[model samples]
Target: MRLAFSLFVAGFVTLAAPVAAQSPDPVAPVKEVMDVTVTNWSDSVDEWKGIFEGDRLNRLYTKELVELYKKASEKAAKIFESEEPVDPFDYDVVTNSQDGCPLQDVKIALAGEKDGVSDVAVSFRLWACEDNADTKNLVSEVHFDVVQEDGKAVIRDIHHVADGERDSVIEELKAIIAQEE
Candidate 1:
């Protein structure tokens, strides 16, 4: 009876050992690398305009960010508001161009969000963001890459390549960014 019991115990140990080894811990890959992507803002200017025109800037920006955008937009519009009647939603009028820049895709990615700061990556479509001969030193588009600070999104830098038609807009934005004292 003792010899039979020993044999059974050994067999059970071998089977259970193999089963435990086959199971994988689900949390093994918990430490993952994340990448935040920042993309050019002007590439998809028209597309973004469409989204915001149908919706509200508040849906897309924080309250502070929206306020800044509003101030800049209003300032620029005031500068050229007399150029023609603009509906604000009408890019044809906003740009005052019979034909405007083609659609270019701009995207931002969040690699990781931790503590108070977020890691991001950004880029834009240079081909579509370029200036035309008619702009005459105006900024057709401005792309901003920012790190949010103190409950506000602060632009780390700006990328501008436009003609005269867009200069007022660029200057207005620079003023707004600078005013975040």
Candidate 2:
């Protein structure tokens, strides 16, 4: 009887391991997006232009946000081809800045969750490359609204606060798409 009980316990433990490992992490999707952004920080401007477009966009963002980005990109392309070209997306959406140093000390945490959605807070410091005495250690925080879709987490929206201004990436994309129409 003792031998049979031991065997049953061992089998249960072995079977439970895979289930625990397969559990979804709420912070994973946000971290994936941030990892790619920081890794390609020093890439050329032309290369960075597609960072939030194409396959990456579809994979990282929610369906609604992806559609908005597509529309915004289309409008920006039209403006670029006109006789007087102007870049609609003048700033980097991810960092919320036109210029910045390489990101460091990146931290991601789950701020809250409600109704099956999670808010992931990401904070990072920009390491200043120059030896300027006046340049402060710049720190920024961006919050991602994440939701599960088809068993995987996707970013539904992004919230940014910079220079005393608050904005949503979704609304900004919509504004860009409506600019010339």
Candidate 3:
């Protein structure tokens, strides 16, 4: 009887161990569009701040934007390389148009997520709290249009909040490129 009980206990432990190992954890990886949008602001606030302070634009910018910036810089270079004097403002790259992340030391909060649109809105607040939050002191709100390109959610455009109006930085760049052509 003792030998039979030991065999049964060993078999039960082996069976339960595999089941426990296969269970998924409660934590989640940031894969979806919404998750990427939030993580970019929350996990990268300091990095964004650095960019605002004249640091290089990293992976946060979309490929389209980066290419446009390159083209704009090339155009400026060619113009400046000529004997004609160039106005600094007239021959500047689009990326240099804005200085860093619009908000400073603010907590990024998800405002909403829309289905089928792949657009996410995020609000930058002064600080975060579990309860009794204040809404009047919001730093700024920004809209992100994300697209899955090459298995990654890239920021296509940023609709920055300015003076109660929203402006798309990408759209502005496109217009500038168009005018130059």
Best by lDDT: 2
Q: Which tens-of-lDDT digit does each residue in 73-157 have in candidate 3?
A: 4555565684442222331121222322323333333344465225455545423332444533445565666655554455566
Cα deviation in Å at residue 62, candidate 1?
0.8
TM for every model, in the order presented, reads 0.33, 0.78, 0.45
For model 1, the stretches where C-alpha displacement exceeds 4 angstroms are 1-52, 83-108, 128-181
Worst 10 residues of 2 by lDDT: 42-51
Ranking 1 against 2 by lDDT, winner: 2
> For candidate 2, lDDT tens digit of each residue in 1-181?
9999999999998987766435467798788888776875654433554446557778877889877877777788787775442345677666877777777678899999998889898888754554764454667888889998767788988888678776798898888988864
Q: Where does model 3 exceed 4 Å of error?
A: 1-58, 79-105, 115-117, 122-138
| Tens digit of per-residue lDDT, candidate 1, span 1-181 | 9999999999988877755433222111111100111111333343333322333444333345446555655555565555432233233212324443442444345445455434343333333535564342333443333444444444332333355232333344447445432
| Overall local distance difference test of candidate 3 | 0.46
Ranking by lDDT: 2, 3, 1
Report lDDT (Cα) of residue 76, candidate 3: 54
Instruction: Name the 10 consecutive residues with the lowest summed lDDT in model 1.
Output: 29-38
Ordering by TM-score: 2, 3, 1
